[model samples]
Target chain A: MRIALLGGTGDVGEGLALRWGYHSSHDVVVGSRDPDDAHAAADEYEATLDAHGRDAKFTGFENAMAADRADVVVLAVPPYHVADTVEAVADRLDAGDIIVTPAAGLTRDDEGFHYHPPSAGSVTALVADAAPDGVPVVGAFHSLAAGRLADLDADLDVDTLLLADDESAKDTVAGLTEDIDGLRALDAGGLANAAEVESLTPLLINVAQRNDDLWDLGVRFQ
Target chain B: MRIALLGGTGDVGEGLALRWGYHSSHDVVVGSRDPDDAHAAADEYEATLDAHGRDAKFTGFENAMAADRADVVVLAVPPYHVADTVEAVADRLDAGDIIVTPAAGLTRDDEGFHYHPPSAGSVTALVADAAPDGVPVVGAFHSLAAGRLADLDADLDVDTLLLADDESAKDTVAGLTEDIDGLRALDAGGLANAAEVESLTPLLINVAQRNDDLWDLGVRFQ
Candidate 1:
């Protein structure tokens, strides 16, 4: 399957692009508002994977073009950009295609990061609301450590909680998740549970900030 | 230090009663709305400890009486009853004493459990609002699996995220959390982060429900 990571110049997008390019044969595409920036990121990702002695399958284009080329489009953009990105690429998304969002809304204060859900309840719901009809929107990878995920040498033995109203779409995303070695995907139920799952990112970030010995924190359930 | 578990006959409350009795030398007390119910739970907890070849320091009383007996009072009650429970025990609590709440507001439907935090933002915030001025309210243990926490034979290698406005009181609760075998405490900053920490409960529940092999799931950050 082809994957178009909208806002692929960012931290999370770069990480997912590298991981998929290194581990699987899927064609990974980078999407940005500026096609030139997307192209540069794609070249850099390819170089990084090549340096690790792995075959790289990566491409770059504008958001709409990238979305049109892939069956799975990951909205790897910031929380504030989720809705706009979905709308920008809505026309390019085909029926039965999935849009995945790892964006978690948070507000930082003197104390630390706090979960700040959108008026629609969660970032995923916001994406689902803006997405075109028949295009499934799924919430995933909301709690991954992007820096660690981008590093090929870093060992990832963590679980990613998945949420969506569509079971088939959820399973497809889960399959992509498990395709990357060491990442496990566990279904956390429908979009209603999105806030609960998305809120975990800030908690993980807070714990990681306070605990010096622990870095790039990832969660596991046992 | 003496510790009291208000609403100690319930799932989470009873689990705390058993764990503290079996693991630490601190005197553990059970508190209930009905004194008779508290007494029965205390006796049962002592018997369980005795059967495990452990000496038990367990007692029972009404909520107000229990609060008066301890420097640390844990409001291990349901989310809806938090403020009322605090009000009922307020007169018995002394200045500088700590109140710990593991309550998380959640509403369940056909889709599963969704976080239903109060208008105050989180259950911990609601608790802090109801608690007396000089008394500190700290949030802990909201994400624990009570059935696993109650079982002495189950090996618990998990982390608990703590939130509090008072640094000294937070340290005190951290010490108690560390007292339990295999339980590590990580400070998650001030009470503002409570919603993120408390919201983890429903996420764990939803994941546990979907994954058959996983039960009584506890989080470990790696």
Candidate 2:
């Protein structure tokens, strides 16, 4: 499959590109607002894979260009940037293409952290609203740790909750999600249940904060 | 130090209880809404420690009683129950007692998961508001995964973010967080930053959902 990591200069985007390039046969492209940065990241990633004895084809381009050439486009930006990022690439997205978002808005206070949804309900909804008509926007990957993902040597066994209204789009994303070894993809109903799933991140972080033994903690549903 | 897991039947509660009981001299107590459940969980934890030849003292009680007896009380409950849980156990809590909350409110929609804060802003703030006056409320453990924690055999080399208005309480929670092996505690500023920390959960979950090969995902700052 042709996959594009929009905002591919970021920690999560870089991690995704490395993994897809090294672990799968899919074509991986790095996208950034600055094409130069994207190309530079692609070079670094390719070198890292080369050092590890994997010869994978990785390309770089502007965000819109990356989205235009791919079957799947992942918005790997921060929660605050989700809508703007999608809007910037909206024209490049096609009818059959899938767009996925994993951003969650949050707030903090004297005691600890909590989710802060946009007035539109969730960050994912914001992205979907910003996308051009006819494109499928799927909500997913809202609970992954960037550092853990960037570590290509690490073996992961974890579960990801999937939420989307478009069944076909969700299934396509689900198929993509489970393709990686040791990762489990679960259907967490639909987009309406997204808040419940997204909220778990802060809970997990808080648990890791108080406990002594867990750090960079990941969840695996029994 | 005396530690109490107020909802010890849950994954995060059990994990914290087991780790402290097995790895330290701190007195570990299992607390639940139902004292019987606490007793059962305590018994199992004790047996696990005993099999490993660790001489750690563990006990069980209702959450209120547990809070009354411990220097530290972990309100390890779901997001929706945080305030009520703290309120329910408020009277038993003393001035020097430290109360910690790891819950994050989030909402979902057609796109993906996003953080959902209560009307008061962050869940942590709500906890402090609900807590008795003078009883220090510290927000910690907002991002660790339960499956990684419950497994005694897992290797955790991750960082826990801490936020609080009380420096002493934050320091205390930080000390407790790093008591276990392979964990680092980071000062992610004060309560003002709790929203940023807590909001990362749903974003991580969303990333896990959309990506292939990530599960039980965690975060580690570079």
For all candidates in order, the CA lDDT equals: 0.92, 0.78
Model 1: runs farther than 4 Å from truth?
none
The prediction achieving the highest TM-score against the true structure is 1
Native contacts conserved, per model: 0.94, 0.05
In lDDT terms, how accurate is model 2? 0.78
| Per-residue accuracy of model 1 over A134-164 as CA lDDT, tens digit each | 9998999988999999998999999999999
DockQ of each: 0.86, 0.09
Q: In DockQ, how does model 2 score against the reference complex? A: 0.09
On lDDT, the leading prediction is 1
- Which docking class does model 1 fall in? high
TM-score of chain B of each: 0.99, 0.94
lDDT of 2 by residue, B71-165 (tens): 99998898898888888888888888898887777777665676777887788888888988888778777777777776778876766677787
Residue-by-residue lDDT tens digits, candidate 2, A65-117: 99999999999888888888888888888898999887777776554566667
Q: lDDT at A3 for candidate 2? A: 89
